[model samples]
Target: MTSTILNPYLEGNFAPVPDEVSVGDLPVTGTLPRELNGRYLRVGPNPTGPAATDVNHHWFAAHGMVHGVRLRDGRAEWYRNRFVQGDAPNHSPNTNILAHGGRLLALVEGGRPPVSIAPDLNRMATWDCDGALRGGVTAHPKIDPASGELHSVTYLLRPGSEHLRYVVIDATGKATHTAELPVPGVPLVHDMALTDTRVVVLDLPVTLSMAAAARVASGTPESGGEFPMRWTEEHPSRVGVLPRGGTAEQLRWFDAPRCYVFHVLNAYDNPDGSITMDVCRYDTVFRDEYRGPADVLPALARWTIDPARGTVSEQIMSDHSVEWPRIGPELVGRPHRYGWFGGIGADGLHLSDDVNRVRGGSLEPGPLVKFDTTTGEISTHHFGIGRVTQEPAFVPRPGAEAEDDGWILSVVHDAATDHSELVVLDAADVEADPIARVHLPRRVPFGFHGNWIADNDIGE
Candidate 1:
């Protein structure tokens, strides 16, 4: 292993691709399903040049890019990658991408509002539900399939920012409800969860650093390039629960473990009035290192929150190192059977040795893992040592009934060739070979969350 203390985010598949290219007729090694006639869009940060050479140079904050592939009637039509154009302050939304309310949105946390991009992968303007949305949004919002509405719990990631916003937008691109819920401190509310009856807010331990904020304000040589958020014991880790469409006055806070959760797998309201949440739990992040993720990796855990008794019971479903968890698109705010995740570390998010020989890398991910939440069963698919797999998104088969009846799509990077491919694996048989692989001409850097936007869903 390379023992050098290099920023792992800037090397290997985590490295950014220069310039944008549009290529047609990408080669395919297997047959493309005729029913799959939509664009598979994956996005991540791709710095225009080199990132800042400072301690604050983090993977979370960088220029955004969206790589897209179009499929029509089982034929690979085209592939394109474009830099998401944004010059406004706090508008660099380089985290996640999805289609909602008949529009495409590139998302980020904090005061940066979601930016609207065209279906062709070009930059547009900062969107706000046609003025129904009054403020910023979250990258990880849940879309209700039954009602065709979007529910989000967003917060301002600024120094001394002390409140969270809960916004609900309807199917017609209009905000129906919005409220500001108060929190104790400037916690890093990266992700949130939802159920049919209530919204789950993760008021965890990671909060803004006033010292780091001073560094940012000064712009001095001593404090150049610093990410402002860090883990803090001063801020208690609490899970705030509130009824759907309710105000901050109704929010009931429940105490939780001193942990951080970047992504929530799925949540549901039990018949007994308790909320069940499955999440990727991290022991701590941004503790020792201020740049990006380090220390202990995340494990799959389930938290049972009982508002009636004001208690939460935490259980580890598995201790495997993993991140970027996903369920069936329609299963948001509902119970789910299967969850797909991207693996990390040797087992996941742990130091390989006492010498600490490695940092985080795109090559460190182990497999595309599938967990049966009901039976405590696990299955995984690896693309070998050098070929790293990012998040696996599940696209359900058209008119499918079974929850696991879908194709798991992911972007896999091959280090030997320095290129990426969109691999389609059968969710029923995840350990099997890819059902289809669409080859790209160049490498796609390992980044963040994405989804398969069916033409029908977006009215293409």
Candidate 2:
């Protein structure tokens, strides 16, 4: 990998797009080294703070306006910009959450948005989201264009644990219906994903040894058995698909892998009203499986869904380990391609050998990758600077003929300084260099998930 000592003050384009295409060329710019780059901080796979929902990568309809907050100068700054717009709120929850169309779409069991933490254990809340409500529109809401309704999942804390309730809301943020969901072998539900006709809930099983269980009863640190030591085999992963209407019956259930984050990449509704979800299942045999925090298990196999019968089929297109799976727009009558930054072993943060052969670390930034379902071929576009990256969101060009063909918008992290930048890529071929890079004046504190909501769509 090419290594360059990062200049804390050097700003401008660290690496500019190639004037000419080459397999191993890195971009260079003369801009002053701005210390405000995002490379200085690190955000883990699990998003911290506030309960927001509906974080689908491709959910935003357009971008005339966007609203959210960024942590800068050790403080939270609320933002309302015309970059993307639609009916989205700026409130931050205590857990990880985001919504589309005024609905609490997907839910994660982590810290909420609008949070502040320091090295000395300083903690403070900047915003308040009413996540404790059970049957109403949750902290985040997801709207289903096909069904013309907002979908939400609510969790109710009860004796010993919490149970979930699904709620459907109208466009006006009014709850229309509510139903209980089933999650066996799991005591905690981290996040829930939705298909047009079905809902998939990923649950984490509680495995406490008798001793730890007793300690929990005695209000003491549960010693050692609070979590199971079973690394790979039969992880606490489980998936459930429930119909959207007409009895809201469960159509299928599949075992899923334990994900570092709760949200599913994406699920599609099949012609038969069944659902398919792409998930990363971690195997138990890998001795190094429990490397990081037990909650942050390394990702393994990728599986496709068959919600009609509640089953999952693994797709072996790429044997490489993948993380943060995302679905692109459909192409050639097929659903959008699936992709995630990949690696050979644990610590998906680093580039593996397969990526090395190309430009030797030029692809080290863990290129934005895509998997064509029809051809099973993979393509990657890299930012020479190796830094942590998140699932890139595809923003279709205005008046683009095909949804699959458009501009890809992403937040890239620079390894040298740990700063992040908003980069635009050509969707058709991710291998191409960025079309535009907007450097934030300050570090946009690292975050887990986000979406692009256009302004025209949201009601005034």
Candidate 3:
């Protein structure tokens, strides 16, 4: 008899919650901010009973479950968690959740469209932008702060496919325009970068591999080779800079080394007609083991691309390990002084062999780090041991003057209690004690992305 070894993603804080919960009047540990009248919603993988224990279950295949905390008038009003149901029972958008065009959406990569969720996190349905979205959208779409238009880059899910599109949706939730392009072997374009004048497309080395797919097709509890993508040596890692409304032929390309980027902190246009993109860059990911991301960790690096000279320069900003970087709300595709990242430390480098291990180790967050771009200064706030934090979203205070004048909100999980709480800290001073903490009724499994949706934006 062959033994079934569980995937590391199915254990510890990475595990899923069984029931959909709704609780009212969640207890607050400190005073709540009156200016904050919104909900913080986050989505992640939550597979049901048998799938969670299945040896072939990949972390990316689980269904999407969103956990939300509603706050209004200096009170923690309610807490709710709901699944983002897809067309089929098994398919769900388990990657990222955000508010766009006055609607809440759950998003995933690989050519899947967005799933809509109500404000109360009750129901979910596949949203096709009134039948205008001809194809799937990316998980990380950059919404222009000034114009409120959403920009995205979409790719076909299959390998060796040449289909890629640059989709633009207007402020009213309508598909405005799409620029189609033909490219080499289909790369897993996880995220995109947006500047004022153009959009940055990442055509990286990691592409859908038939070899990897064949291994996954065997359907066994093997030690490795469970994922469906691999790093392709033939596919040259490059950056394609496309003008906002320009077509495929107008794209300017710059070649780069073999690397992968799952997220972009921010990108902006420099004065010299070049682009500056700061990203969490991994040297190489999905090369060998297909279980999760790279066996190595990602470093904070800035890539300066000069289209005129056909050159790309790399600068390592911080050697310390960090992920889930966030800047101010209005700084998307714009230059900003400060950025926040969840400190990963060293424990996040690889998966542990012990599936039963828990209690504040192995990929759990360490501290909330603040990086000053102008001064090269770093500040961090450690939540002590056994307490880990998720992605920190920076919300500017009402009538805020300075760029950093705001609050940082994130879901913090405690290993001892197996519980989670929404912690709010001053963006200007994250090292200080939290200004408010909204204790949740249940545990929030380690999730991917979340955002604070204000009432006025949703027309509440």
Candidate 4:
């Protein structure tokens, strides 16, 4: 067996911890907000045992592990870490964690159902939304702030399947609607955008490639072994728009350039019969090979879909590479001006070719970025060298009036000390130092999305 120490994904902060831990009353560097009471929970991939050299593991193929910190009464409380229990063969739920229908679900994009977990991180049964879900659910489901409904476009990787399912779960956590939409190939729809009146679906050039899958099965050295999908020039890149309450027959497909979007900032309907969406656009992904970091970087871009003309217009919003775009929860499916993201800073410490050659080598997420859509200005908070940050979740302060009036919560990993800290910064002034830094017992590996579940929001 080849030691995982040579695999970039299993080394450093990306390495999986050996055991789960529970601690209380963690130490803090600054004052915690008295009004803020919630659990800051994050989920990511953590392999169960030693990584297999012959298995061709992808960074995303590991088991799911969750880390959480409780905050209340202006003080740091408990911190707990646990593995998400599920029935899937791999049982890796490392993607996004969110609350819906009063239940907390750990979600992965495809292949497996979501696993419900308790507020204290105890694993529950696998959730199928009362068997309403026909296939795997998307990790990025848009919850309408006004209607309290959840919407998603889910796909199944089963052979001989050529359709995607559009699902809507009611506020009470019941699957109300499911529609099958036909497509040419099994394209990866990692995320989608929602507006007041429509749902935006992305069908990019990256699709399941049998040739790539065969190469991986044969253990070809150049094959990005874990994921069998790859970018193909033959695939037609397009975007589809569907009515909020309508079916596949009413869906209109619009042509888009050859690019990919991993996450959308927000989308809203325009009075002129057009829709505007902000997203982190990558020039290409899963292209030549998927062994390591993408050769292309993603930047914020605005896409305007004109249904009448059947065309989509795109304009770059920023030049810097960024992802995990987020806005206030209240602004979902509505117009918003401010957005936040995590990206590589100006220092460019992790982008070198050498780093990109190894899997998960570029794990250092450099800075937290704030984008002002109203004025086209970009502000950032750089955490300096050797300190990496994860996705920033915006927590609105009590009685907050402005959209940006909140605290940005992120888990920062310090390589110098091999420890992690929950850093909180006022969203209004992101360039300033963090308002509070809650120390953690161990490093939280690079992971996907997380949320701040308020005390009042957790189910009793």
Cα deviation of 213 in candidate 3 (Å)?
2.7
Query: Per-residue lDDT tens digits of candidate 2, residues 144-263?
Result: 655556565644322333345676655554556766665433243434566655566655443222343454356443221122222333445566666764233643557654443333
For model 3, the stretches where C-alpha displacement exceeds 4 angstroms are 1-6, 214-225, 346-362
Worst 10 residues of 3 by lDDT: 352-361
Best by TM-score: 1
**How would you encode candidate 1's per-residue C-alpha lDDT over 1-460 as one tens digit per residue?**
8565466677777778888999999899898888888899888887654363443367776778898989888888889998886547545678899988888888887777788888877656788776654367888988888898888888786766779989999887789998889986778888888898888999999988888888878977666456788899788888988888889999989899889889999999999999999998878888876666665657789999998899999998875667889999889999898999987743334333331423442225657888899998888887776777869999989899999998998988887899989999998889999999999989888788788988876755
- lDDT per residue for candidate 4 within 1-460, as digits (tens), equals 8554456666677678878999999999988888778899999877765443423556776678899999989888889999887765656578899998888889997656788889988656688887766377898999999898899897776445698888899998998898988987788888998999999998988787787667757866655337766787899889999999668998899998669888899999999989999988877777743643454666688999999999999988776667788999999989999999887633423223353533343334668888898898888888767886868999998889999999999998888999999999999999998899999999898877899988776654
For model 3, how does the per-residue alpha-carbon lDDT over 120-204 read when each residue is reduced to its tens digit?
8876788878765537888899999988899989887765679688888988898888888777888889899999989999999
- Give the least accurate 10-residue stretch of model 4, judged by summed lDDT: 346-355
Q: Estimate the lDDT of model 4.
A: 0.81
TM-score of each: 0.95, 0.59, 0.93, 0.93
> For candidate 2, which ten residues in a row score worst on lDDT?
56-65
Q: How many steric overlaps does candidate 4 have?
A: 0
Instruction: TM-score for candidate 3, please give it.
Output: 0.93
- What's the lDDT for all of these models? 0.81, 0.40, 0.81, 0.81
Better of 1 and 3 by TM-score: 1
User: CA RMSD for every model?
Assistant: 2.2, 11.8, 3.7, 3.2
Q: Please say which candidate is ahead in lDDT: 2 or 4.
A: 4
Clashes of each: 3, 65, 0, 0
